[model samples]
Every structure is written in C-alpha cells, then in structure tokens.
Target: MSLKYAPKYRVFLFLIFCIIKACDVLFIAYMIKLMLNLASSGSKDVTELIKLATIAGIGQLFFTCSNFFYEHLKMTIIKNVNLVLKNANLNYLVAQAKNDTKSGLSLMTNDLKQIETGRVTAQLDMCYQSILFIGAISFAFINSWQMTVIFIVASIAPALVQILTSRLITRKAKVWANANADYTQHVSDSLNGAEAAKLYNVQPTIISRAVNSAQRMEEALRSMNFTQAWALEVIYTVAELFCFIIPCTIGGVLMMHGQLKVGTLVLMVDLAMNFITPVVTIFQEFNQVKSTDPMWKKTLRALNYSKNPHEKAIDQRDDFIDLKIDNLAYKTNKTNTEIFKDVNFSVTPGKKTLLMAPSGWGKTTLLKLMMGSKSPSKGQILINDQNLTNDWSKLHNYFSYVNQKPFMFDDTLRFNITLGRKVSDQKLRQVIHEAGLDELVKEKGLDSPIGENGNQLSGGQIQRVEIARALLSHRPILLADEATSALDPHLSLEIHETLLKNPNIAVIEVAHKISPAEKAMFDQIIHLNQTPTD
Candidate 1:
C-alpha cells in the first residue's frame, strides 16, 4: 500500500510494518484452531479454551493499537511534508521547474491523496490477514499435506483470474485520476468566473463542462467497481464451489477406505471453513494492495516534482534601494520565444519611471519579472547592486504591486484591508481615506462581508480595496499596472496627485490614462515599440 516515494521513514517503518503483520497472522491462526476445537467432541476444557481465546484477542488488541499509533505517526509525517512543500512555495517552484500546472496539481492532489490511501494501517492489516490465511493452509498441510496441495492447486485458478483482471483495475484507476483533475478544473473554472459565466450567457457551457467532468468521474469509478465486483464474484464462486469440492472429495475418499476418523473428518470440514475466509480475503486484499501501487505511483509523481533552492534562502526586508536590471533576458518556452533580451533599466529610490511598450512587446512580462514572478531566462534584477530576484524579501516588503485586474478576498472590509494581519485601526482609516474607500466603508461598516472577489463592489471599489491592502504593507516603492483604468478623470487626478506629491513615496504607475499633466508625474520613461508578427 505504500508508494515508491515513501518518506525516509521507510528504513525503519518497513520492519515495524512486517512485525505487525506477522503478529496478526499468528493471532488469527490461534483463533481458527480454538473454534475448530470447540466444535469437536470435547467438553470439560471449554473454560481453558475460552481463556486461551481471550489471550489471543488481547494480543490482537495490542497489535491493533500499535497499528493505529504508527498510522497516526505516518499522518504526521505527511503533514510535515505538506508544510515543507508549502514553505518551498511549491506552486511557484513547480511552475518554474515543471512549468506545467496539470502535472503539478496531479502531484499535489491526486498523488498526495493516493499516498494517504496506501495507509500503512490498511496495508499491514491486509498483509496480516493474508498471513493468517496462509497459516491456516499451513495447519491443513500438517494434518494432510496432500489435501493442502490440492487446496493450493485450486487457489491457482483464482490467482490466474485475478492476474488477468488486474490490468482493468490499473486502467480504471488511471481514468479516475484524469476524471478527478477534470472535475477540479471544471469546479475551479465555474466558481472563479460564475459572475462572468452568468452575464455572458456562458453558464450553460460551464454546466456542460461540469456535467462532463462528473460523468467521466462516475463512469471511471463505475468501470473500476464493476470490474472488481465481477472479478471477486468469479473468484468467490469458484472458491466457494472448491471449498466444498476439496474437503468432501478428500474426506469421502478417506472414509471409503476407513482411513479417517469422524473427528478428523469433522476437523477437515472445520479447516475448510476456516481456510475459506482468510484465503479469499488474501486474494481480494492482495488485488487491493496491488492496485494501491498505482495510487502511490500517482502520488509520488506529484511529490517528486522537480524544484530548485529547496528551501527559503532569503527574507531581506527594509534594505532595498535602487531597482536595477542587468542584461536580463527571458523566454516563454523551450524553443526560445524570447520575450525580452538584454533588457536593462534602473528605478532609483524616490524616483518614478515609466515602462511603455506597444501591444505584444513583453511589457507585462517585464513587470511580472520585476514583481518576483516570471523569472528571467538570463541576467539579473538587483537592489543596491545585489540581486533582488535572488532575494525578493526586501523588494517585496519595500514595494507594493497592483495588477491590471485586482483580486479581492471574500471577507469584511477590515479583513480585506488588513488581510488577517494585525494593523492598527487608525491605519485602516488612513488607507480608506487615501484610497478613497470612505464611501464604500460608510455605506457598509468594516464588518461587512465583501462578496466573492469583491463582485458586489464596482471595479474602482475593488481597486481601492486592493490599494488599501497594499498600504497596510507600508511598502515604499509602489508599482501600478493600469490600476486607475477603471476610475473616471476626477478620481484618476486625485490618485495621480497622491502618487506624485506624497511626501516620500516612490511610485511607478503603468498608465493608460493619458492626461495633460501625466508626463510630469514620472521622472523617466522607457518607450517600447510593438512587435511585428512574423
């Protein structure tokens, strides 16, 4: 049930796992013997037999407790792995390293989930139960090895059927993994853009996609379930028929020659009954255990996603000065669709700079690179001649960025403004005033729940809210990406004044609003020409 990606715990846990399984098999065999003896013509020692049974039960109890404790410990390990993954900024890391969201998501979700399913508890439980069954077979062999051989020979039929059917289980599990991803994508697409889907008459399309996702998931699950059930039934029917066939044929032959006692005959019948459950259980759970390999494989596939700088190396704060780029180049893909080549620029402290580019000239790409996203394919971005991209903590802490489409969390004005941080209420008032959020706050107090992504607020209100959140960071250097595009002239003028005359603020606005006085706001400009499509 464990994956190839079994954490370093494997070196120790494997041995413990085996010991726990061995204990269970021993316990089950003792119980089987006790039951057979009870049904035999023996009486006065019933109390002794029950006492032995109690001891067996107690021993099993100890193993069961150990099973749970170790399982819980394993869960802790998994959670620790999650923390490591989260700290590693696995999303950004995987995006940069694997460069594929689908594969990354699979590794994070389906792969991790499957790893959980391969719980050491479940695996050990099955393995131990199988061990008990084989123990019963061992008991039968002691009494009559020839009959045991016949029993095992009959077992081969089920094994053959299982081997042939295992391929189907694997195929279905794969389909299930794909279906799960599709369903998640559908849910994300629909929920993230519910308002747009509704307004643009695309709700039906989203619904159709959702349905397809769900149907695919259902179909895959159904196929797996049906195949498993069919396989089990075939094995069970054959097993049940042979259970009678073996004992009856062997017992009758012995009785005809007067070679067996009634007690031995009765014991054989009891042995056959005892053997049926465990043997079938072994076969069935073995298939389940086998199926788990793929699940673990899927999970490990995600956990094993390649990454660089496996740990956080920098958290620089409050030391940022000039934002300088040196011979930077970046590509969009492996085939060298270079977005920027040898681009160099600097925005000094308390100085404003403009980055202008015609459509499709990698303007946004450059902006993203500066903001700790979309890393450059070549060269570096520096703060005080030391790399900012290498350690964006100072750059991040000292600067605030505004994207073209602002994001809003579904929370109160207080939470939206402070983002769950401990900021003085007085600062909130200033941010609301500076960002001109007074009207929104006045209409509904700070406690008001903003609808999902600020859908209830206008574009301007959402932008202001995002700005208010940024102000809470107190970043000295601010970058705006067409942030004021939704605002009217009057509001734009007020925002421009705040950026320009704000005593000690270094602000760079990616302006789309071309006002008469706009040129004076920025100290430098880099005009970028449009790219000609080939």
Candidate 2:
C-alpha cells in the first residue's frame, strides 16, 4: 500500500482544521473592521469593545483546538508512512537474487528520514496553506476587488521561479542520495573487516579511506542545500515585496483619497497579509517536495518490484534428491572473465562424493551454484532429472550446507545447534555424538553461551557444531565447502568418516588436500581442472 493510505481519518481532521482556521481569519478581520469604525466615530463604549474581545477569544479557542488535532493527526500519518516504507523496502530486499545490503540499509535509514522531514512535511504544509490561500482571497475580494487583484499579480513572479528551478533541485537530491549510499557501504566494509585491519596494522589507512568517503558525502549535501537555499530566497523576496509592501501602500493611498473607508482599509490589509502568507509558504513547500522527489521515486520503485514468476515450488515431502550438473559455467560481471566452464558432475543419495580442486579453482562458486545461490551462465542443474531452476527456497529444503567459516549467533550451544527447531533430546544427543561435539557439550553444558560467531570455541569445535546442525536438519543432501579446513588432520578424518558412513544422506565435499587412503574411501572423486579461454 502507498503512504497516502495511512491517513485514513486524518484527512477528515485536516478538513475540520481548515474550516475552523478560515472562520477564525474572517472573525479577526471583522473585529478589526469594528475597532476601526469605533475609532473613526470617536465612540467610547467599553462594553462593545469587551463583547468584541470575548467573541475574538472564543474564535481563537476553536482555532487552537482544531490546530492541535491537525498537528497530532499529521504526526501520526508521518509515523505510519515511515513504517510502510520500511516494510516495502525490506520485502524487496528479501526477494532480490543478489542484494546490496549497504545501499538498502542507507535507503531505509537516511532516505526514509529525508522523506519524513522533507516530502511529508511539505505535503501537509501545502494542504493547509492552499485552504488558507483560498479563504484569504475570497475574504479580500469581498472587502476590495482592486486589492485582491494586486495580491494575485504579486504572487505570479514567485510561482514562475518555482517552475524554473524544480528540475535542478531534483537532480541535486539524487546525487546526494547516491553519495550517501557509497559512504555507508564504505563504512560498513571497514567495520566488518576491523579485526583484519587491526591485525595488519592498517588502522590509519582504513580511517583515511573513511575520511575520503565522508568528504564526498559532505560535498554532495552542500550542493543540494545551496540550490534549495537560493531558490527559497528568490521566491520569498519577491513574495514579500509585492504581496505585503505594495498591498499596504496601495490600501493607505485609497483610504487617504476617501475612496476606501477606514474599516474597509483595515479589513483589506489583514486579508492581504493572509493571502500572501499561503503563497510564500507554498513556495517553500514546493522546493522541499522537489528536493525529496528522487528519494520518493526510489521508494516507489522498490515497493513495486515483482518476484520471479517462473520460480517453481517443489513439494517438501519429495526427499529423493540426485544433483546433476551438465556443462556448467560462470563468469564475473565486472571483468567478464570465466571462473569455470564445461563442468559435469553428479551426486546421489547414499554416496560420498569428493570434489578436488586447487585454490582459486572456483570450488566455493561451484557449491553456491549447486545450492541455487548463484546461477550458471551455461547449462542446467537437475534434481531427479527435473531442472532445479534456481529456486533457492526449494533447494534449501532438500540440502544442508556447511561453509569453511560457519556463522553462529551469540546464544547457548544447544540453541545454536537446534537453531530453534523442536528436536527431541534423543535425536539431539545422537547428532551431537555423531558429529564429535559430545566432549564440548560435556565440558560446557548445553545451556552455556557461545560468544559471537562461536569465537569462544576452537576452529574444530565450531566446525563440529556446524556439522551437528546440518546432521540434525535431516536433509538428504549435505554440501560442505572445506568444512574441515580449520580442523587438525585427525579431527578432520574423524568428521569425514562420520559423514561418509551416514547411509541415509549424500555427502558432497570440496577438499583441497587429502591422503591416498582418504581418497580410497569415497564412492567417487571428481578432480576439477581450470578451463583455459580459447
């Protein structure tokens, strides 16, 4: 849903506010006219003055109450719109095949805030001011048509200025948004790699890079602010000159010539000010909305993104999985260089397959392609002779993955192992023992917390915990990308033995180094040689 849908009841509140505000303006004009007439007649009736004051005070009360409700409703609408924008952006991010989280993060945090402060505020201001402008012009025409005509003529120049500079403001806004995204991405990259920076003693270099990013962001923002300021100053200056100064001068001359009564002149001056107020306010609001146009367009684009219609959903109960890759290939977009080509492999349930490749031979990339995290530039991956079709969710249900470095949350050992799944104590103990995690569980009870990313545990222990998680998932296929790379040879052999002996699951592993004895135990060993470009 669009942000406009959020103000379900606020529209009615705004209308009530406008009506009461218009009536208050009319009452004030009448009170001013009465006071002028009394002064002209040299009359001293204190009771008449007290009655007018009482009526004016009552009008002020209603105006204030309406305004209170209006402001409250406006705030509520802003908050609701913010929430809607965040959810839309989040859904879009989740649906993306390859998402740039840094850019998305900046859009939700910075761009959304800009929409709230600039676009939403400008819209509300324009709405309120439009009503006030119409009320003022109607009242002024009733008092003196000549003065009302003068005010409209004065407003023409500011309106023209707004038309002339709108495109420039929008372009500047887009530049600022892009620069902010780049800065956010740079900072996120540095923070994620802070440990490496410290280890390499390159903290100064990282800080320097961050400073450069910040400078670029500041430059873009300064340009946007300058353009907005210049536009606002020109419009406000012209509006003030004609709408206020000229109207007051003309009214005074008419009163002096006896062409206008003192009371009429007072009413004309008040209405003239009221008419100019909205015109000036609208000019400011126009600039604000223009500046926010780019971000709003980005948000709209994200909200309207459609998911892939060709994505197929396989039945979860179909557990017989046989992975077959036919002439698979991949290339990098930036360099247009192939990582691998014409690769053929097959893995079936109840067998152990070892994928052997040298470093930088795209072993991990191949694993990702099989898991549907990345799509091949050539060939198709099939399960049970049907095309896998790059549906990660369907593949996710059939396979469990173990990376060289597995991610762990800062939670208890048992919580990390089960991952919030309701597994019986019997199954949990079985998997823990099978994956060689029994000793760790005994040393530190299941309730004990593992630090962030399992930093408290040794590399072997972390790898065992990851294997335990995969074993407990009960998926038919297990894809491991150097799962035992960090473990000692004996532990690695033990883990490999446990996985290979599992009769119910297929184990496909990428191994960099293995002994002759280890190679003999696998059902099939596929060695990948890098394909040279023709």
**Which candidate leads the pack in lDDT?**
2
Clashes of each: 2, 0
Least well predicted 10-residue stretch by lDDT in candidate 1: 307-316
Q: Compose the digit string of candidate 2's lDDT tens values, residues 14-44.
A: 6667667676787799888987787787788
Score residue 357 of candidate 2 by CA lDDT.
Answer: 83
Q: How do the residues 215-311 of candidate 1 rate in per-residue lDDT, one tens digit apiece?
A: 9978987887787788889888878667667657877898689786555555555565556666666667666655556555544444566544544
lDDT (Cα) of model 1: 0.67
RMSD for all candidates, in order, please. 5.7, 3.9
Name the regions of candidate 2 deviating beyond 4 angstroms.
5-7, 11-30, 38-41, 97-101, 309-315, 329-342, 373-378, 390-397, 408-475, 490-504, 515-522, 530-534
Predicted structure 1, TM vs. truth: 0.72
